[model samples]
Target chain A: MRVAFGEAILRLGEEAEDMVVLTADVAKPTQVAAFGERYPHRFLNVGISEQDMVDIAAGLALSEKIPVAVAFAPFMMRAWEQVRSTISRCNLNVKLVGTHSGLSASDEGSSHQSLEDVALARVLPNMTVIVPGDREEVKEATEAAVKSPGPVYMRIGRDEDVKFLDEPFRIGRAVVLRDGSDVAVISNGAITAEALAAAEGARVDAMVIHVPTVKPLDAQAVVSAARKTGAVVCVEEHSTIGGLGSAVSELLSSEYPVRVRRMGVNDTFGESGTYRELLEKHGLSAPHIRRRMEEAAEKRDR
Target chain B: MSSAVELADLRHATDVQKLKERIREIRRSILEMTSIRGLHLGSSLSCLEIIATLYFLKMRHSPHRPRWKDRDRFILSKGHAAPALYAVLAEAGYFPKEELRTLKSIGSRLQGHPDLRTPGVDAPSGSLGQGLSIGIGMALAARMRGSRSRVYVLAGDGECDEGQVWEAMMTAAHLRLGNLVLIIDRNGWQLDDRTEEVKRKVPLRGKLESFGWVTYSINGHDIEKIIEVLDSAEKSELPVAIIAHTKKGNGVSFLEGTNKGHKLKLSEEEYLAALKELEAKPVCE
Candidate 1:
């Protein structure tokens, strides 16, 4: 996902002279180092200063420059005040991409891992949040964010092992990856790969949906799927508190009432473990998601 | 260029006495804004001459062409001074002076702090310690675009306590953004206490110098001196930081030297007294 992000910006940089890249000393980890080398003049490495990086991106956006700010997912919130006050307040066209999001930083523990980035980004007024399913979608989302007007926040995991199921990327639109009518299983971010695995293994014919754009959610897609299946189950690599589940429930609880169950970290912090182990421990693995889907199917308001 | 303003028309751009009048006029406008309500008067008063010198002299801008690509950018890093900036912008004809009274009023474009919706406001800034970083970004962009424009940021001394300001200072110097200028309004007071009392902002010049800035200490109220340093700043090979020593609520007899009226709705007597004080004296003695 990080590599795709780096490649997408490099390609876009060639076509758009206004595009500038900034990183808070995580150029290699975020994989933006290649672009920095290719376009030295258009890139800035403000070491360990996320607030300055975010504000600088705002300033660059104000001057009609498209600035793409990348950093470790957890550190992006270090500049959350700047993100809210300057970038979102002015509604500037800056794209912020956070790599190593979620349990991908599993071996590094909770301090490095970000379970709340999606929640934080979702609340900003003008911010558009996307959690791509894989490398292809990360590239697509990166391109879409820069092309779209206003600020965008994307959370991508460091897992290169995730499956790439590319559906055309558009801002505020959800993609359906598998078709069924029993229950609608919605997931986003790298964890959607696990959802796909779960759908294949589950006995119930679950309709799987991948919502890359978490904010400005595709209510039409969510409501129609829920109406057809009579139940909805939301999953993410983030905490269930304010992520996909909360977003879906908030929308459906108002627009189309249904039995919605949330699947992810249940209001707890991540501990040191392997990437797969953390996802399994946090109930984001295929087995956990499959069980949730089966439970929702049996319990739906029939 | 045909759509641009005629710089030749602004004679006050060079004359010191006329510029002094310009500062006085801006103060009167800010007082008018205060009449509508609020006591952000002290910080606004503190940075007058520095702003006046830039707007009337050093800045390459046109109120008629506020978004001109080559125009110098001025950011009030100490955004509590929005009233002062709005006043000067109106006087420069960015908008009607009649709009001054609508400041912070519901639905007014003059937000309690500066926002781009207000004509001539380059960036939204009520949040402190942010202006300098924004200025650095603009400077970096200007250099990348090869535009012959400079960026200026006016920050409050007490506002320097923000770690973000120091972060910006370090980065600006490391980037060697010589095209950027930061003027710190050393007004001695913040919300309800002295900057020195609340947090020691002294040894400030030395701190900036150690951070690799081309530091200068000057009387912030001296328009001519402010102009001199700003003019010389263009030739600097590193970013410039000017410590402009000033008084809070400057030039007003009762409000001077104190942070009492940090934000206030003026009483009729206090309003008349402040207005009469400025009406009597056009410039500081």
Candidate 2:
């Protein structure tokens, strides 16, 4: 995931002279080491202070530089006030790349897990929240973020996520992994792999929509899909609140009001375990989504 | 009033009386706006003359071309003190003087803090202690772009309690950004209590100097002294730090030197008294 982000970053640098990157002591871990090695002047490592890193990024952005600040998701939370005021308030061109999102830091436990990052980032005005499905989506979203006008929060998993899409997907355009007519399964980030697996178990026509950009969401596409299917099931590896499930719920509530069943981590803290075990323990497996979809379909039949 | 001469000529001319009148007018604007808006009355009074000197006789900012590439940039890092900044910007013709009345009103671009979306503001500031870093970024950009434009940032004394300010200071000095100036509005008071009691930043100049900054101290309300020091520092070869000693709520008699007035809105009687006191003060040096 980090390598993909790095590749997209290099491409953005070639396209935009204003592009700059800052890291809060996470350059190596986020795989921005090569960019740092290549563009030493444009890259900054501001020690361990995430708040200062954000402030410096905003400062760099004040004078036409498109600053991309990279850090662990939990550490990025330390700079929320700066992010809200200096970046979002000013509407500065800064993209915040938060690595080890959700329970991707499973062994690192709840301290490093960014379960609430989406909720926190979504509330800030002028902030675009994106959680890419895999390495391929991360690359596409990073390229889009460079052209994005204002602040953006992009979540990328620490582990190598399941890659379903072989082609570059347009950001904010949900990719339909499976084409069905009865129900649409909406998922994002690393968990879209599980949604694809669960699609095989559907008794009725089922489709899986992959959303990379959670904010400035493809509302038109989601509404159209839900209206066609009459029912939607949203899944994510993170908590049900303010993640993929909540984003879909918000969209459904206003634009595409449909019978929706949200399958995600139901407001629980992730434990110390491997990523696979954590997903299984939290019922974020393909079978869990399949079971939830069948039950929703049964209710609609009644 | 300053010699009946244009702003460009004021740089070389030391007309203290006319400049003092400019400071008084700035104070008048602050008092009137604070009475109407009921916000930043204390902080506005605190940095009245500092604003006057920068806009009137110190900085080279063009109102017609706010985004002029060669113009100096100022960031109010202590953004709650935006009334002073707005009053200065208005006097500089960044906006109409009458529009100052829209302060803190719904849909008014003059928010409680300095918003870059507004005409004169270079950066959005309010969440404290981040302005210096932004100035550093600006200064670095100017250097990289080979432009001689300078960046100035004003931080509240209390705002120094934030760790980000220090980080910015370190970055600026590390970069050896001679084009940057950091002014500490040493007002001694914050929202809740006195800065000395809350979080003392004694030897403030020493701390900045330790970061390889060329430091200076001056009476913040003394426009003449401020201009002289700033002029000398601008010629220096290192990033400059000016610890401008000021009284919180300096212009309002009832509020001056009082911690209670740091963020308080004036009542009807208090407003009337403040007006009377401002009217009695000498208009010029």
Query: lDDT values of the candidates?
Result: 0.88, 0.82
How well is each residue in B1-285 modelled by candidate 2, as lDDT tens digits?
A: 666566746644546667776667777777777667568777777887777777777788899999887788898998888988998888889999888889888999888888886898998888888888888778877776788888889989999999988888877777788999998999888887888888888878889889899999999988778888889878987899999999888877777888756666667788788888878987653
Q: What is the interface RMSD of candidate 1, in Å?
A: 0.6
Candidate 2 residue pairs in backbone clash:
none
Error of 1 at A282 (Å): 1.1
Query: Model 2, chain A: how large is the TM-score?
Result: 0.94
User: Residue by residue across A144-214, what tens digits does model 2's lDDT show?
Assistant: 88887889999888976467887576656777788887788898887888888888967767878888777
* DockQ for each numbered candidate: 0.78, 0.61
The docking quality of candidate 1, as DockQ, is 0.78
Candidate with maximal TM-score: 1
State interface RMSD in Å for all models.
0.6, 1.5
Q: How does the DockQ of candidate 2 come out?
A: 0.61
Model 1 Cα lDDT, one tens digit per residue, A1-302? 78888889889889888899999989998888999999999999999999999999999998889999999999998999999999998899999988899888888999998989999989999999998887777888888888889999998888655665756788889988998989999989888888888999698999999998999999999999999999899998888899989999999999989999998888989989999888878788899989989999998887
Model 2 per-residue lDDT at B125: 87
- In candidate 1, which residue ranges exceed 4 Å CA deviation? A164-166, B1-14, B282-284
